[model samples]
Target: MIVWSVLIALAGAFCMALGSALQERDAVRAPGHSVARVGFLVHLARRPRWVIGTAGAGAGVALHLVALSGAPLTIIQPIGVTGLLFAIVLSALFNRTRVRAGQIAAGTAVMAGLSGLLLLFPHSAEVPQLSIGTGLGLTGAILALGCAVFAAAHWVRPGPRVLLLATVGGAALGTTSALARVVAANAAADWTAVFTWLTPMCLAAAVLGGLFQQNAYRTGHFAAAYATLLVVDPVVGAGIGALLLGEGLPTTPLNQVLAVGAALLALGGTVVLALARNRNPEALRAVADRDEPTATKPGNASPGARASTTTTSGESR
Candidate 1:
């Protein structure tokens, strides 16, 4: 079962990478704020690439669900880091450009740090349950916090905006994943758990996270945005897992230091990769154009970064 779980999780990882690449391609081409509104979903309904991307993501999620049924979160969660590796490949292929050694080193650093973090988390056989009322309260709090971040994102610069949204989205992803494990674990023992606030909360978080990722993708650095997700999602999950579930943290000094060191290493890689040459230039221009509308406002100014437009294939990412 462990082997099978690992295999299934790997498949999910690949599918996730494929979906994001495809989605990012279309997302970059999309008019600013279009996908954020209700109308663009209706617009997206007819686009084949976007649809395919959605399908790929859905399939990956489905596979993930299956994988979790057999594997512990500790094992399966780290497997998600592989998605970044896959995305790196997809980005190079689509751009018809060879990847730089630096990018590969950066990606390796991220995966290594992620693996170390996962190794530090403690696993337990226990499954914690929240009363429907408690679950609802927690869900509300999470939503309020995430929405606050989302709102704050609009008032900030692009880099901060991306980070805030990614963090919010990652928080949602973590909570949703933790809740899912709880829900699934208790489904047989308590049928009532299947019909509670957890279900709705999980769905809502998943949707919100997906929306955040979509918007983040519009920034044109597929690897950059994804690297953030890879870091934040599991850190959040580990936190929630420790507090809400029976999951444990590094108790030993050595484990704690190692985890922090690994995290810093990953962060260092992400910082270096952000400046990679392969990122689409049109995205910068699009962002600059968006900020233009707010430039004249007292505190709201145009993007500080100068943009260069580089046209790629019909797939703009």
Candidate 2:
């Protein structure tokens, strides 16, 4: 069962990575002006690449749920770190460029850190019977955090703003995963019970998480935003598992210290990837051009220029 769980999780990671890479192109290409407008999704929905990417994302979500059903959150969620490596590689390939040494090193560091944590500490988790009150409390907490993040994003610099959004978005996404396990298990026994239970909350959180994440992609560096998301998402998942699902992980003094160190190491890789990507800006250039800090004034650029800048390579593969 562990073997099957691990394999399924790995496969899900690859699918998510592929979908993320494809969606990065769309995120940047989405209009900066009308983001808050209702038509934003409608516009993206019409794109061929976005549709294909959505398919990959949907499939990945399904695979991840299966993996979660069989494995512990600590074991399953961390496998998603591979998605960052996949996104970077795929992004480079799409741009017709070679991967940078810095990218390689950063990816290596992320894998190493995640590997160390998983090996050093054994984690076990099972979906528990959460009360309605307890579940509502968890939902409220995540929503409060998201609200704070959303407010902070408007006041900060673009770089930090993107990071904030990405972090909160990851947390929201991780909560969705935690709640999903609950919804699924309960749904198995009483089909309609979960509908009014965690299901609606999970879906709502996923939408907001995805929205913030996509916005971060447009506002932040591609590698930076995605790396933050990949590293943070599982940490959030692990935390949610403990808090919401009653899956307590290691909390000894030594374990606590180690967890912090491991998290920092994984996070440090984002910086390395960002630095490595500085040299080959073309990979993110298509999207970054529109997101650049003071690169071009919207007023100065002609309508045609805006259109050209937003024109994604539209690589659908």
User: Quick one: RMSD of model 1?
Assistant: 5.1
lDDT of 2 by residue, 1-317 (tens): 98899899888888887887777677666765312333556777888998898789778878988998998776886675677777778777765678787787787677767655654444553445667677778778888887777655654545565677788778888888777778877777788867676777888778777877776665525666788777667677767766656667666889878777887787788766654533224324444334343234457889877655445321110
Candidate 1: minimum summed lDDT over ten consecutive residues — where?
305-314
Estimated TM-score per prediction? 0.81, 0.76
- Predicted structure with the largest lDDT when compared to the true one: 1
Q: Which stretches of candidate 1 lie over 4 Å from their true place?
A: 1-9, 34-46, 61-79, 285-289, 292-317
Clashing pairs in 2: none
Give the distance in Å from residue 299's predicted Cα in candidate 1 to where it truly belongs: 17
Residue 232 in model 2: shift from native, Å? 1.7
Q: Candidate 1 on 1-317: residue-level lDDT in tens?
A: 99999999999989988987888877767765512543445555567998998899789878887998999887887786788889988988886778889888898898889888888878777766666676677678778987776666666644445556666777778777777878988997888878877899888877777777776676666787788787878888788788766577899999999989988988877766666666755565465345322333324433332222211121232
Q: Name every residue pair that clashes in candidate 1.
A: none
